[model samples]
Target: MTEYSEISARLAALPDAELTTVLQAATVGRPAFWAVRAALDEMAGVGHIAPGGDVSPTTESVQTHDQASGGGASGQVGAASAVPVVPVHPAGIPASPAAGGYSSGGVPTFESVRDKVEQRFGTAQGMGELDRQTPAGRSADEQWEAREKAARERLDQIRKSVHDNDNP
Candidate 1:
């Protein structure tokens, strides 16, 4: 089997949540990203997946304009592309907007996942097990803390200076 087919098979075997996670984590400009996108597109093409993680099929057709052809008479002909339609909520909001915080299309956003990780295990700036055990790492951490404190003080001084200047 071809590489794409192999990848597509693996992706298709994954559950929806896992597949969405892989799709979100995939880096652009890579074969894996394209494969994941194709898998989702296939799901959408079939009636298996719908917006907001619904199982219903979409029947909306979107128009595709050929901008390269200057949208002339020929360009307008056969330009309609059939795509899955997203369902809208009663409040006039889309079921899943790409810019929505936390999650989109039932996939947790990177920021949301990062925030959860940080809450559970602390931020990346915290020292790791190896760092905590090493004298050099401990010293480095202390130095970083001191530098940050000094920077905060300097920023406060600058803010005070600016405030005084504005008042005068």
Candidate 2:
């Protein structure tokens, strides 16, 4: 009488070899793979699987002046006095929103600095992420790991260069 009942009857008739093949293709842990798993689970009279949940992206962000602020007014507008003048880079000038704020441009704010960096460098630091394999496809995790590795390597390079310059 129900849609699930029809599927259950069909699955029950499946040969052992065919069922194994279907399970192999289900991809229990992959995206969209879960839809197949859920269906298979229903066919096998399996109970609910507690959603393992999603893994969110971990950003590699350094502290800005706002983060160090201790005052209640720090996170709001007109908190410029408390806002730290964060350096755009180790060698570059500090971010300043100019006297007129965004109304007039001199030294840009942190948001502007990020935009300019992207414009000059292109997306994902020119890592060519979209050109890589999808997570469901092979090499997806490896490509992401490679990007993180490259960033860490660049940070190490920056640290070393600054350290070397300090002595000279």
Candidate 3:
């Protein structure tokens, strides 16, 4: 019926991983996200989200708040004045520490980025389409395994080279 209802329906239909991916994509440079974030910050400042002592955004409990604020089904208070002023954080993520913002500090170095990419690649390489028939003369699982092994070997060699150079 309403736009929010439609969005809620669609979101409800998505699996958890897909919903997470969708939310992540929505946060990138989106004006709507920033606006809601600002609203939530304001709510926190005035004591709606959390009242005193180390307001980590993740520790808020808003289900009852959402229902009170006219978000009976969707679990989101659409109006800014509504008790649900944007969710503090999604479910399952651990609450942030109270003392400092969630940051390890400083920009990531190229080496760090490279290492992360390689790690992710290594993790996913074995997850190739094993069910699908490969045109590559080899079975899909064999192909994937071979590719993963080669990639791991390459990463190991690169790491060794970098380590040797750093020590030298």
lDDT of 2 by residue, 1-168 (tens): 699999888888986435634674555445444335434534333222236734553322222223334533546532334333322222232433453223132355577677678787886655555655555434767767899999999999999999999996
Question: For each candidate, what TM-score against the reference?
Answer: 0.26, 0.20, 0.22
What digit string (tens of lDDT, one per residue) describes model 3 on residues 95-145?
333212222222344665777899889766654543244566356668789
lDDT of 1 by residue, 62-117 (tens): 22221133333545543333543332233323444543333334455788687788
Q: Name the lDDT of candidate 3.
A: 0.52
Q: List the residue pairs that clash in candidate 2.
A: none
Over the full model, what C-alpha lDDT does candidate 1 score relative to the true structure? 0.55
Model 2, total clashes: 0
lDDT of each: 0.55, 0.50, 0.52
Candidate 2, residue 150: Cα displacement in angstroms equals: 0.7
Q: Number of clashing pairs, model 1? A: 0
What's the TM for model 3? Answer: 0.22
